[model samples]
Target: MSEGKTGAPHEGPFLLSQLVEWIDREHRNEPGRIIGNLLDALRRSPYYGPLVAAAEKTHRSPTERLRALPLLDRDTFYRHSPPLSNDILTGPMADAYVYASGGTTGQPKFALYSNEEYKIATDVLGFIYSTAGLEAEDVVGNIFLAGNLWTSFNVAGRALENIGCLNMPIGGATSYDMMIKFLQAFNANALVGLPSVIIKLAEEVERSGSNVRIRKILYGGEHLRAPTVEFLRRTLGCELVRSAGYACVDTGPIGYQCTHLGGSLHHVLEGYQFVEIVNPETGAVRNDGEPGEIVSTNLTRLLMPVVRYKTGDLGRWVEMDECACGFSGKTFELLGRCDDLLVIGGINLLPSDVASGLALLPVSQNFQVVARTKNSRDLLVLRLEASRPLSDAQVLEGLEHGSYKLAKAIKDGWLNVEIEWLAPGGLPRSVRTGKIKTVLDERHG
Candidate 1:
């Protein structure tokens, strides 16, 4: 089925949409039935008993009644919930596979997936790759970190295998030299990994003056910025750089990019999950295209079903006409995470936005944003790691009139940006993730 020319949801020929419909057909539009079932299931679990009882107090139909249920944050669901076991599972949990989320620190919470959930996850990835221009004979490199409870590499590898592509499971931790050797030796044509990791690898390729055979790349695990996109295009000689999809260990298969605009938008998995954008301050639902916090409810994940779970990411619903690439579902544009947002002089700033603004100027690939409180006032430090220091005249000239325009122009004078020039290796890397800490918030200390 094809989507309508209007913004209404339409049937599509993609396997992922079909699988979603097959798994939970009724829950796609009329989520009340699933909400009722979820309530009934939650009543049987000690951890969710209070939540269910609270919902039961409302003397309304389960569908209409559940809408008033209080939102559940990570602290309530993972930290404060009563001891949980198989009681949360809608079905038997004997065959379920457990995976933990890659939280920055502290105790990691576990998410359970049944046999069918696993299959659906990989199937979604396969559909995403096929949609993002993956060919059958493509040699794919799975550079996402694996082991230590990480799921991206294994999940991506299975997807590549499912689509009958030649894939090498070279985890993200692999050294630059070894990764390059593997890519060259195996003739990798496509790569999938975190954007930061991919950029580091590309930097190595450029430094070594080697011509790698890779052309296509798909980035996930974090926000993909325009500057990074330009860097990849220049260093890796990539033409097709798209988002692998929007997903996490907590919520599987959020959405994927269609071929229409590449990574500008993502086709929300309408049949599989309910996505909502709510005002961060007031908690009111925002209209289509209004920026707000992204809240997701998983329709297919029966085991440990997440209802109105706060994803902590910022994004908004968008209505599009029939996509030229063929998928007929509504789409969402992902803004950066809520926690990563910086408030400078009453203005909200995203690291990705800063990077994109800098992409307009003549800057290097290496840059970082440091937020600090000076004299009880918020200050933003923009660190640019140029090969050599630029003269005051050059910096002033670029800031005034550049291709993308300067950061101050983009900020509209709500905030002032202080530029700091750094040599290579000037910025520090995160000890845990081995990636650059692009946004450093020092005001919280």
Candidate 2:
């Protein structure tokens, strides 16, 4: 998949056209039928059959039966079927494309997709790239990390090809200087990669005063906050910046951002995937505009049917009217991870909230919130890799002024707040995927 002409063998335009027609006919107008068919198919899988049978006994409707089934978390997913095993596969492994999750939070897990399924996934991505303003004439630089069983470089490279754009398969490991030279040499107008890598490249470009004028940036693998977006605009001289799309290796393409959406908002891939926002504590479905953990079911993935899988990420549905981009499907806003939540001195703190508090500061977007214990007291440390030297008073003032909950927690002495500054590249990143660990709890350690 990584080599020449990335995606499935069929012509890119034909596949994209077919997918668009399918989305309109089945996904948008008759989603219930799609879910119903998916449920019927899962009932035959050895792993999901008993669970579906149990849920079917009580619930008459497809949605009700799906809601009744247990949510599959990461631990539970691997427990039932370990990596590289056929325990969870509904079909044989022949002619299947295997990819592995980055394993940033845990050990890496592998997923299989039959050739037809792979085509569908990439074609959906190609459609999303078009929505994000990627043009067929544009030369795109693909800097997403490759190898180590990672899927981004391969999948994204393939998707770009499906868009009929000229793709420079420059993996993320290349030196920033070399990458810039390659972009210039290729006259690349758009670049796609992890947010951290893009930021680092932008910083280097700013430092070197490079004249590489990339017109668009499509990022994935991590959330790109507003400050970072602005930084990229200022540094790279890019007119358009948006998420490449919302997806994970385990679940495939889930949601996508169009030109109309910004700041964690994405339109669900209605026909390809079903999304649900559920209460983190109770697992009950959340109403639109209410925050909850994101639960997803991939409608097209029959090889390793991902049904009602807990994504561990937090988000909420955005009430839909007609979008400016003409996508009438469901939309949602992504919050931080459920696992990144920190309870300090009886106050619940989320990494997204912390990032919001520090958003206005001059610090770089890459920062970490470390929760620890000091003298039997809960301490929260904000570790920032400084763009320039900053005072403790300045950071505290920003945090207190920006977030109301954090302000109250500090005022009442429920939390002890400290600031730690480091030079660029001081913070640790996940070895496998090269993404920042947003929150770390050393309270128990």
Please report the candidate that would top lDDT against the real structure.
Answer: 2
Compute the lDDT of residue 72 as modeled in candidate 1.
63
Query: What lDDT would candidate 1 get against the real structure?
Result: 0.71
Backbone clash pairs in model 1 (N, Cα, C under 3 Å; residues 3+ apart or in different chains), count: 1
TM-score, every prediction: 0.83, 0.91
**Clashing residue pairs in candidate 1 (N, C-alpha, C atoms within 3 angstroms):** 1-11
Task: Give the CA lDDT, 0 to 100, for residue 83 in model 2.
Answer: 60
Error of 2 at 336 (Å): 1.5
Query: Which 10 consecutive positions of candidate 2 have the poorest summed lDDT?
Result: 1-10
**What digit string (tens of lDDT, one per residue) describes model 2 on residues 1-445?**
2223322233334555555666777765776777788788787677888888998889988878877888888776765554635566777778888887635967777777888788778878887888888988999999999898888999898899878889999999999999999999988999989989998888888889999888999999888877677888888888999889988888888898889888889999887887899998988888867889999999878877888888988899898898997888789988778877788866788766776657677777788889999988999988988768689888888888777888898899888989898998788898889989888899886
Computed on alpha carbons, the lDDT of every model, listed in order, comes to: 0.71, 0.83
* Candidate 1 deviant stretches above 4 angstroms: 1-40, 53-66, 80-94, 360-366, 384-432, 435-437
